[model samples]
Target: MNEVAQAAAAPGLAVKRNWLAFGTGVGIEIGAADLRVSVVRLRPSGARLLGEKTIEGFRHRPAAQWGAEYNAFLRTLGAAHLAATVLLPRRELTVRTLPMAGVAEKDLASAIGFQLDSLHPYAEEDAVPAWARLKG
Candidate 1:
């Protein structure tokens, strides 16, 4: 598959991905109590940020709206498609160590989810979980 499709599928496949380009699309960032929207243009080295404005007059905006707006923005940038990456706040993600044996790919998420369910009683779905194996 191409880069954009690969990036989008990576998350669902339990792999990590990043948005390398805006591709004629905009990005919207939504927080629990805050909302942000921006359009961006990509360069070979970095990105040119545009539409750095806050959308007002909305009491409760769904996260999906932000995503759609971002995609539309990318289209305006002359990009045939766009890459979407959901950036979770650092505070929302709890990174910690865990002991893991020879684990299979299918079981890894469940294993971590099980462990985190205890530590994160509030909302495990709201957070992202990752792990690593330390050298002996």
Candidate 2:
């Protein structure tokens, strides 16, 4: 079985998992000086890197231009169907972790939502909050 879910937590991104034992994922990292894109195929056996691209000085270039270039790169590798996980530099983001040891998976969002305001400086109206539950 393959389940595809549109994550309300992150707009314009889709999460998919296959019980058939294989899937694909794309990651785009925005570094200090460049935009890097990579695609990988995940199977029960292992993860295989499909393709990658590094666009230098992406900040100086128009987003539409570079975005198209990146899109083309994915299309060339037949990975245009995958939703990319965009990674921003750590310093550029405010990262926080909470001890949700007893929080059930279903209530995770509400647990985070209850503490959202205290976690960041942005006002509720202006802030866009995203979180992930990591297994340590």
lDDT of 1 by residue, 1-136 (tens): 9997897676544322223332544565656655465666665455677556454433376757854664565556554264545555566666677776886768977887688877664664575556765777
Residue 78, model 1: Cα distance from true site in angstroms: 3.0
> Which residue window of length 10 is worst by lDDT in model 1?
13-22
Pairs with backbone N, CA or C atoms under 3 Å apart (clashes), candidate 1:
24-74, 24-75, 24-77, 25-73, 25-74, 25-75, 26-70, 26-73, 26-74
Report the C-alpha lDDT of model 2 over 1-136, residue by residue, as the tens digit: 2343434445534233333458889998999989899899988667899988998888999999988898899999998888899997876677887999888999999999999889878766877888888978
Could you tell me the lDDT of residue 6 within candidate 2?
35
- For candidate 1, the per-residue lDDT at 122 reads 66
How accurate locally is residue 134 in candidate 2, as Cα lDDT from 0 to 100? 92
Query: What is the overall TM-score of model 2 with all chains considered together?
Result: 0.56
Q: How far out, in Å, is residue 59 in model 2?
A: 0.8
> How many residue pairs clash per model?
9, 0
